[model samples]
Target: MPKQDNLSGYNNTGSDTSVFFLSGIPGLEAMHLWISIPFSSVFTVALLGNCTLLYVIKTEPALHKPMYYFLTMLAVINLVLSATTVPKSLSIFWFNFREISFTACLVQMFFLHTFSSMESCVLVAMAFDRYVAICNPLRYVTILTNSVIAKIGLAALARAVLLTAPVLFLLRRLPFCQSHVIAHCYCEHMAVVKLACASTSLNNIYGIFITLFIGGLDLTLISLSYVRILRTVFSLASKEEQLKAFSTCFSHFCAILMTYTPMVLTTIIHRFGHQVAPHVHILMANFYFLLPPMMNPIVYGVKTKEIRDRVLLLSHGKNF
Candidate 1:
């Protein structure tokens, strides 16, 4: 269970204070309790998986490199992203507590998109790491130095902040005079903005811009990196060398799909899918937030040899 909880203690919806009522899965309110079973379980698994990944990355000295450091950033971002949205959703489902203050919802929107963008930026960094390792092996270390990675991390945060901070001011200007009941669970950008009475042309424009900027640009860069990586791998003299080169990228490619596909689909569907049911949109939103967090470690562990070996050693009570 994660999401827009009493985080920062912003849940007082008094008669005077403006608050948003979250209608958890509009059409399936009756099934909330039942649905929360999987939600809570997935949340638990996501936290455990990411924590375990962090622990493994920390303890294994052999895993200390740019690739793993980018992975570490991804893991932390996954943890925060899941923490931002799932628990509150589960709370709403299980206990029928779906009230969230406007301030709290704003905080939720900020962090939700911030970490999501961070995840995207981290993926791009990972793509670049793979690119250098595959396409420019000799210069990999010099290109992805520790200080450089630190700069990349900071740059990611700065970019996310630059894009998402404006959302707060834009939201503050719009007046929610009609119903405060948001059809979905958390305070998603478009979802919250849709409840506004004023013109949301600016908000819509910004939302679309953020989606394309983060998802579109990052996807293009990653795709270019992989395309070059594949061309480099194919040029290797031996079949074994080609396989080895491609194997290194399998986990990262899976991560790219896990993260971008759902996010892009959700944003597109939200913008254009008028015929879709409310619960369907909400479920897709939940999946967008939850899937990557839960599956990332498993994908990495199973696909990448080092993490898998370290995890197995720890599981088997052996020195890692």
Candidate 2:
């Protein structure tokens, strides 16, 4: 049980309590229960869906290609990202934020940014795979060998860790103000930073720079890769070949859009629409977290014939 529930009202300060006791925000209990249902539902679906994707790729020899390797990495990252937030979010909602320690929040934020950035890197890797397959088909095997793919995955992981380490390091220096209430459902970068009593100018600047570094850089690289892919597709002699090449990349494009669009929209809403409504923010938050993972498996299932068939084969007792 949360110590916050024992409190009579929001502003009550009589009782000395643990620093980590998640309390303060109004109507948290009701909000937590309300959000947990959908959060759990979507989290379960994402976990199972991504796990099935990993299994299909791993078990099916035919699916063991560079594209699927990167896809599996993406699935693993999403699975980890969902785990980092959903349980804590549920705890925050159901029992109040009393159980979450400052160290835990720092840890959670670190993992969240790490996984999210890694997903971006994986998307770029997938784009490179597509570029190679379409633009230099003859060299696909030479360029994207097992060793090369392993290097790419390792590089992505290292970059994610290095890029997000600052978040924890920088956050540790700030002192919390009196208001401990985070407006949103989770301990997001902005949400936690907002509680700082000290100067956050450097944090905000670093936050924006990091956002641009990860998001903008990856998007630019992916776009350039696709541009080359488009040229290669157009050069194909047959319409069927062009369509097939485009179809191969359609799901990836969809996944990219799903992942980044909400972020852009959320920024828009936060900057221009703060006073709009609370439910709107909640809806956007849920969509930001849920839509990409839920849609990723479906996109792959519908677009990639080999993955789709393998998933079906695994569903039944058929050999892949």
Report the number of the highest-lDDT candidate. 1
Candidate 1 local lDDT, 132-174, one digit each (tens):
9999999998999999999999999999999989989999999
- CA deviation > 4 Å runs, candidate 1: 1-17
TM-score for candidate 2, please give it.
0.90
Cα lDDT of all candidates, in order?
A: 0.86, 0.78
For all candidates, the clash counts are 10, 4
Error of 1 at 16 (Å): 3.4
Candidate 2 local lDDT, 154-267, one digit each (tens): 999899999888888898888774555555555677777877778998888888888789888999999999989998899999999999999889989999999899877776
Candidate 1 backbone collisions, by pair: 1-86, 1-87, 2-85, 2-86, 2-87, 2-88, 3-84, 3-85, 3-86, 3-87
